[model samples]
Target: MAELYFLIYVIVFIVGAVSGLLYSYSIHLEPFVVKEKFNIPILIMAIIGWIFTLNFSLFSMIPSFILISIGVFLIGFVIDMRPGYGRKETIIGMIISILIWLITHCVIL
Candidate 1:
């Protein structure tokens, strides 16, 4: 039962990682490889956190999303505190993943 819910997160993680790799491109920011590495991983973690909280009704999703966003950003902030870490891509991916999750649960089937 609970294992099935965790399986959802595994799928989401794979999707996030594949997207990060598939869309890797050069940008004036840091580097796209950083996006594939740091960005996607953080997004994966965020999604997993969201999925775990999803045990509750949709009413709790909004708050779960808020916390997930905060946690991801805080992680990016801390990671960026170190030199050579890319926060921009991490934040971007985090936003994108969360939006997709929100819409899937809140809007579309």
Candidate 2:
């Protein structure tokens, strides 16, 4: 189950990567998805989702993950630790990652 859980998380992360390519405005009737990959940080920040839902049942993991996430973001952005970092896409990834948490909590252990 844990293996499957992680695999699902990978799929969710891919969805987030796709979301990163999308923009609010589109060129003509198509090309809303950007050709340039600008959201590498978003894809790399997949751990954020895992941390976000760590507290669904385990209270400690939740708070710890939240703190760690904040620290990573702070260090990454404030210190410019990472290049090609996309905040928006990372946020999207975090939201999408929650699906795994929901599934684990509601359907599995």
* Residue 80 lDDT, candidate 1, scale 0-100: 39
TM-score for each model: 0.32, 0.34
State the lDDT of candidate 1 residue by residue for 33-68, as single tens digits.
342355555456445444433322444646654443
> Distance from true position, residue 16, model 1, in Å?
0.8
Q: Write the per-residue lDDT of candidate 2 for residues 1-109, one digit (tens) a residue.
A: 7677556555554554444334222222343433455445435454454344443344455455344444344323312212233445555555555666677678785
Please name the candidate that would achieve the greatest TM-score relative to the true structure: 2
Candidate 2 error regions (>4 Å) = 1-35, 46-87
